[model samples]
Target: EAAIGIDDSFYRVGGDSISAIRLLVLCREAGFELRISDLNNTSTIRSQAARALSDDVISAPGTTTQYAPFDSFDEETVQRLKDNVVPGIGLSWDSISDVAPATPLQRGLISETLRSDGGDAYVTWKITSFGSDMDAERLRRSLVQLVGSRSIMRTRFALDPILGVVQVVLKEQVGEELVPAVEYCTSASEVKARATAVSQDQRWGRPQTSPLHIQIISAQGEATSMVWFSHHALHDGWSFSVMEQEWRQLYDADGEKPISTIGVDVPFTNVSRYLAGRDNEDDLNFWKTYLADAEPVRLASGSTSGPPPPDANAQKTITHTTKCDLSSVARACAVPPSTVFLFALATALGLFADSDDISFGLILSGRTLPVDDIARVIGPCINTAICRVRLQQTQSAATALQQLQADLDEINERG
Candidate 1:
């Protein structure tokens, strides 16, 4: 209910690491470049601007990688994966360029969507407003470049008999049609609604088809809004920041060259391979011990016996006013506002379930993987984690907050 001033703090206003990526992208596009760590340290717009753009010190972005398929595996291994994956779908061996493992989360989402058959769960839409800066044709070219730069945008997900879920990356020549041609409308609102309709349509419910749909709505030959329809598996909050940064550069930084000339430094497929190949023995064991005695906090809606209920098709948004100064509370506890919010969430859930012991699902960025330049790495690189908290009757409020803070710190370090 409050407007954020330039001097306002991001986290204090409820920003997180993932949103910080988006903030940085918007800043760079507006002609001021900043690092993620800058927001982690200060988060206020003026301080960030002063420090980042001093003496026109915009740090140059890293170079993008060219089209090199499946460098992690040997030529023979990649070819074999392609061979096994081809028969599962309708693609031919010659049309397949390479193969990579799907991100664990993407695999789960695909499975759930397939099981449910149809719903708005995995389908996502993103709209970004643009002025008449780039002409219609140029904007269309940028969309093409966007598809070509990232393999996930042009790839298909297939369940391989031996390898489980795998991403079948098609040859560039074959995947060129991944991005839909630009569509027009008299008004920006009409285009946005059209894009939403496209997202809600179940024609592309299966994962085998291309998961990307785009509409560059132009009114009177002037670009207005861009609608990006994608399966949740293809992108995350982090991916949106990465994609927008590259997309803006398509017509700005590399305007004179062909879109095909550019590529991502770390393709989504490469990140997936790294994530899938990691040894999770320690992680698994830690979670097993951590949640061994934790009881899930669920709504006490009487009938708890039969198989779990199906997902409710309806959606609702609830808003509440806490009437508490969270910044003061965080300062008293010697923790960040986010930590305060975490404890608040735990306390609220415990109260709802009428249980002191509670366990909840938390979404982690998975950006902590030991990969190089992970902060800038793209894709749905997210992990679902269980956060367990036991609030003892004897403990003081401050004591509980400190304990939760310690647990969160450990989780961040481990991830």
Candidate 2:
């Protein structure tokens, strides 16, 4: 056994969940039975190396992949993916006076929409036999403590005419009691199946209002929980997926206190600062031209009613899902899933609008902070951009894809 360099400080070399899976596969190929949790416990490269050496596990060198860090152009792409985050001005609010004084992050969330329709945001989980050694109260306390310590689970709002300022409010537990709901197995297959179903249902049934709600219900004697959130406005699909992942991690930790460094370092407040510093004249001009002389299409088929008024507060929604094997498409295009998804969405929106004048909003991950160490903070880290696709007489999907890639390249380059 050889002694490898062991650094006292832990550092993550930018490996996400997918990368962690790849690492696990590589370790297995090298005859080492390593799990994803192993990577979490040994976050630093040096630490992981030491673990492999200590176990006398001769593993092959893992392939390294570098990801582009967050930046302005990437910010624009993220804004396009999100539904809110208008340019130049802060969230377009109907009545700021009626809005209660909220934390900066909460204000940003509320201001994006017109009205505040307080709704329920609760999630549920079922615990099978609380492992003869498991204490229900201890688990509950651990969950509460985890929620209190994490800002992503907290509420963020703004106050007064303070354009860029934000305030954050931690969410409190409304009730704590393990109730019987449904029974499921504790096997990995069963747990993942249940979690995926819950995730899908929540994704499809998501609402569009404010005062975000989350609920978790655990069935008696079942190690599964049904988790649900009130609306999609407070958080996007990706956000919910992330929350589920972290919750599972915490649960597996068995009420053991988590490391303080596991918390999110970059809050959405920095996004506000980024927007405030930029001259949004171009973004405003793009939107002005995009919406000019355009009318909102009636959402449902066979509706005779005209489009709703153009008030910022007026509520409107259109849901359309494009059926395509995204993973296969990404492989063919040699681009990340995000790039492919955004391109398809942008193209579909442009085609549906019946004009080249189309602009969509997206959310960005703003982790480039001088003081922040982790980049997983919640709040609205999003930006907006116009994906102007000129329709030709006979445009093929390949051509559209090429054009989309070029547009993304330009947007990213400029950012």
Best by TM-score: 1
If candidate 1 were superposed on the true structure by all CA atoms, what would the RMSD be? 8.8
TM-score of each: 0.71, 0.44
The C-alpha RMSD in Å for every predicted model, in order, reads 8.8, 16.0
Best by lDDT: 1
Q: Give the local distance difference test score of model 2.
A: 0.42
- Backbone clashes in model 1, listed as residue pairs: none
Tens-digit lDDT string for candidate 1 (1-415)? 5898898766556665556545655555454555434543244778776776566646445322323556656767666666666666788777766777787788888887777746446877767667656465577677687776666777778886656778877765543466556677787567667666665566553577757767666664454666667888888887787777777778665565544444544567767776666687887777677778776667664235577557645556889865988777765655567767878888887777777887887777766554445566667877877778897889987778767766764565444
Error of 2 at 22 (Å): 14
| Candidate 2 residue-wise lDDT, 92-180, digit = tens | 33211111122333344445433434322322222222333433334455555555544444333433233332332333331122111
Which lDDT values do the candidates have, in the order given? 0.67, 0.42
Candidate 1's C-alpha runs over 4 A off are 1-80, 119-121, 126-134, 172-175, 184-201, 222-225, 258-264, 301-322, 413-415
